[model samples]
Target: MGVRITYLCVILCTSCNGIGIGIDLARYPIDSPTSDEYLQMVNRARRSLAETGCASFPGFLTAEATAEAASEAAAKSPSAFVTDSTHNAWQLPDDDPARPPDDVRNVRMRTRVASTAYDELDEGGALKRLYQYDEFVQFVGAVTSQPRLYRLADPLGACSINVFRPGWHHAWHFDESEFTTTLSLQQAERGGEFEFTPPLRRSQAELAEPAVARILNERSPYRVSCVVADAGGDATAPPVTTAPFAPGTLQIFAGRYSLHHVKRVADDATRERLVAVMCFATEPGKVNSAEVQQMFWGREIDRLHVSPMSMRANRLVRSVFLMLLMISVATVVTAEEAAAEPVPEAKSEAAGEAAAAEASPAAEASPEPELPPLDCKTHELLEKVDTWSIDCVAMWLANLGFPELRTAFTGNKMDGVALKSLTMEKLAEDYGVSEEDQRKKIYYNLKDVLRKDNAAGNTNHYSQMFFWLLPLLGIYKYLTLRYEKQIEKAMKKYKKWQDARNPPAPVEIKTFDDGTNEWTRGLNRDVNLGPKKTKAEKDEEKKAKKIKTPKAE
Candidate 1:
């Protein structure tokens, strides 16, 4: 639902005085900041982004919903404002002839938009402490130090003055860029990830080989616990290790060569990873192939970025198509009477016709929602708690393309913050008592009732004072002494929020065991990662096992 205006804009790249073939773009190494230095860097970055009317912020990439818990929500912001553009990059040609990609390339360019930033962070100015290069070099150097974490991708090659707003699920497919950088001017709630199957590009070739298919389908005998999701804080995934998405911490990745999914992150995980997409590509807008042009208008060789107006119109069509695609994927159901076979209830002769008759319709009440065999729903539940905050997590939900949890309530109570705060004051205006008594009464009433701290399940802003206090107390020298209580409280709130979003379903009470009164229930709780292996997975498995097991009788 973004108010996007797709246009026909050309990538005006500055070719370095006709640099020719045989020259791969030079890469710069991005640096890592010490823990202490990171804190300082974050504060400074925050101030800088805010002044430019930008929306940049920090987030702990983690799965822990409680405050201060490690997370996996790693992202940079300012995506809303960043313009769209195709990254001109390296592409291995197909037999020396490249096949183009499908979809539209809606490009936008962006520049620094943080509030109160240091003046002119360009080539001329260098960090006095690090004592390095000029402003531009220093910035480039900072990002280049860690090629995997901070890729400099600028359209048309050379890093120039630019910025961009990457939309939700910004790039559904892979990119040829070896790595990309972001500054996080504004962060969205969901539907984006810089995921890749590292070294998978090589494995994919092996996987495609006819002989290798059998080996890949076998169920891992040992169900060793693995990371289902990381808010950028958890790095259980192969290669990239660690979770936590700290803003301003530039990210770099070889996207094209990697089988990565820029996941459609749910609202719960959206608030964390806020990156500002910054590119320092040697050749900015040079596409790996003209095939990239085809992505704008699928299978249409004749039509393309011919006009900004036509591109805009085409964007609308694609948007509608995408909407249908999402819905279709979300609601696909199988009418497999075999897989969905129902277990029957038992009836006793002593209870006779009455019991048999009563049990019949009890079984026919409702059918289960036709959903994917995978328990993607459980993952969704875990996501809610994984991305928690004192705030209602509005941004995260929005990012997922889901409506806000409190949308109904907010709409009904629609008052600005000042009005809401003042309402609290008005609620406490009941006294002819002395000034001191009135103030005390209001304070007590407001504290104990509106926002009771000691209450078990109720909460408000007052109760969350501990969240603010613990993180700041002498930097809370002893973790054991403090932070624990506040952390637990925040976790509790997260649990509550999680529960509300995905309430448990009522169970069906039925006859006991075959005859021994051993009650049985089929817990169809979709509580696992996606649907269990579908036909596709089963078919692969069957094909693999066939080689070992006896063939058809």
Candidate 2:
């Protein structure tokens, strides 16, 4: 019983990482194949990927592009070339990652992917080369028949010129397809090994079962590394080996069904590996995830310099003006008559779609900005509390997962100095909390910021307070006096950010009964907040009831 429990325990642990045992399918010691089949396959896959519009690799250029896009690259789902239709291309990372994982590694120096036979596309390009130049395809065919690959065509895939940096190591992960080809464009100074464990390829029994556990728990998993390590089970087994790769060498390997990790480079030399991806799907142009694509939306940013305060203020003013205008018109006139206003059918349909999209499962999972308490006094008091703890608040917001604090409390620049001033002013006040002397002088002496706003564009003291509370209160009451200034500043950054990577979907103007217009983001009225009206107000609203025309409705 003790032995059985030990065996079962190993299986349970392996299951967590998806491994198993006692399986012939996990066979290693594949005496390198001698045929030229894979070379033809590689050439064909390359052509197919090129033929499709959406597939390509990352581009690593300046440090700025590197920082802004690194987190995104790792987060993206693996997308390979398709067979029939085009895909959205702008979402791919601007610069490939410096590491070996597809997110960081350069693919141009390694290999070109080719169309697979299963995709039902005719092979002539890289696929032809995979078989003719080398028996690469033959080696793969001998191992696993009909391996999937990215189809390559001209103009050869978008990123055929990028170079690979040394120490680039692609880690173990399941591939979208069964097989992948890495055509070496360049090698690292040292240590560019491809690693894999064969015991992970079981088909009949779940790889997470007891069978896979014993294999990894054994001591010889590393001995079977066929690419760069000694690939032998016992002392008698032949030492592990790898074929030297050149510009034309086509190296096909089992990826989807195998657990693999590329060895890191030893030196600082940049190694280039330009490999294209190929795959099969239930449909011709199935998408991966909506969140993945949103990353690409704001890539083409406009160069506008706006202070954080101004930006927040602009958004607040615009939102409030629009919101107030709407409420006023509906209050003065009637809801039906306001909606009766004429709108383009295309615009209406687009708005409907945008709303529907926002209401989707994917959208609901995204962050939902909470509206602050409607009472003005409550919002003002909260701002007073938040203003004092700029340091504490900054830390709190950071831990809350808000990415804006990259500079200060949020992204870019945070008005730390301005916060100190506000803290001092509040402390001097006789307000209930600020009146306490034990805390008063402690927060008052810190005025390092007020002396420094010589040309500070974000000199607005309450800018942070504005945004921090807008979602809850719907508007910033204090800054209403600085309306135009705030609006001008925010519009600049919003326009800039929009033009770049995350171009917001174009908005449409929807006019209401009173004298106001609102930007409709094409979202639906599905926010389950319930009938935006009170019963007493509903009765009073009947005196001016307005019926909309069916066409204009």
Candidate 3:
């Protein structure tokens, strides 16, 4: 009975955490990276992605888990934000009226899909669990060949559920992200297919404008492949080939260069098509802009306008709540142990006092402990600072008695480079660091980290000088180049004006008494005839030439 009760408690605790339960570990084995099966799975997905710009796993989630996720999405469907707008293949507004009608930029299509934003997901929901699962993230990174990947920290775009009700669809468009990961929880009764053309752009340096236009204009039937999550047959004309994807399948697609869209569900479809998009980035601190959040999620997250004090207070409340929950769990376990084997009253009292002492807040002590001095020299710290992780920074901040700033720092995904750039103003304005003294504490400590390094005759001093000097040098070079261009232009214009103002003298033809002709050009040359010839003389020469010609004949 005791063992059964203990097992029941474990199950309850596991369910409450909701971390790994959503995934099918036995089938996928993403957590076991060293296993041969894991390597095979990764390699297979990589090959598929390389060939078709997408990869799929048919049973990424268990059937039960898929049902649970579908149910959750269905419940939230009413609250989902619906969007019905016409957009171009680039997903930009048709703001450039000068663009030609045949250009892909001007070719517009309609999208009418509803979305459940990241914030709308429940903390322990199956979709959320899969999205936050470290193993799943790692697997995706492996498939995409990313050495490291971080989940998007955006309040809205991070992980969203996309709903395609009957007669609704997503238009042909390229994704802004390099890669997109999605899991299908449910499929419509009919028609809602995912159709895509292979990557049109060869690389980031060049845009395949003509090919994209072809796809956007519905002229690339041979290149189109219709992927139906529940259907097995592929088609052409509308879609070239059809592929099957069962519900619970996970797909990672390189959609940045591929033109793809979800086909409209049939008007008579019995069920809605539901898919969850899990967003990740190569770099941390990835958040959507306010405009994007508003456009998609129907609201905006004004991080700059938020109050730091209030955020800290909220953090404290959550921390206290979690602490209380832990304490309750511990009390229950302690009671169970006591019932299993009783202790003397005095011993129990003493044990309770020790536990209380350990659990008590440090603020209750006579006075809080002072922050420890840095153990490493400035130069040494500088040498290894580049390798420091976010958690390392958090611990350092905690030691400095500024644990409240951890959320702000982590939310921005600050690294050593970002830390070096942080200023008191940025802290106060962007991060809501309103308290003057707290700002000084953080800003000065960070400055000291570098200042001491410079004072200690480290390479950082020279590097810092070089960095400061670089921009000035660039500005000087740019100004010099610009000035040279202007001077050259001015000189060319002056030469042209001089040439146009002083026209060359016309050539003069002179006839001499000997009948020799001389040509004088401008004022530079003088070809002297023996004597000047009058018009009467010219007539005499003409008569002479005529007489000579008659005599020769």
lDDT, candidate 2, equals 0.34
- The models' CA-based lDDT, in order, is 0.32, 0.34, 0.69
- Top-scoring candidate (lDDT): 3
Candidate 2 error regions (>4 Å): 1-144, 147-164, 203-205, 208-244, 273-553
Runs of candidate 3 with Cα error greater than 4 angstroms are 1-19, 202-205, 219-243, 289-291, 302-553
How do these models rank on TM-score, best leading? Answer: 3, 2, 1
lDDT string for model 1 (45-105, tens) is 4443223211222331111221111111121122212323332112122321131231011
Residue 354, candidate 1: how far off, in angstroms? 99
Candidate 1 residue runs with Cα over 4 Å from true position = 1-173, 189-193, 199-243, 267-274, 282-289, 293-553
lDDT, residue 341, model 3:
17
Instruction: Please give the TM-score that candidate 1 achieves against the real structure.
Output: 0.23
lDDT of 2 by residue, 247-278 (tens): 32334444444444445555565533333232
**In model 2, what is the error at residue 78, expressed in angstroms?**
20
lDDT of 2 at 334: 22
Per-residue lDDT of 240-311 in model 3, one digit per residue for the tens? 223355698988988786678888799999899999988888887777666557667777765333235446
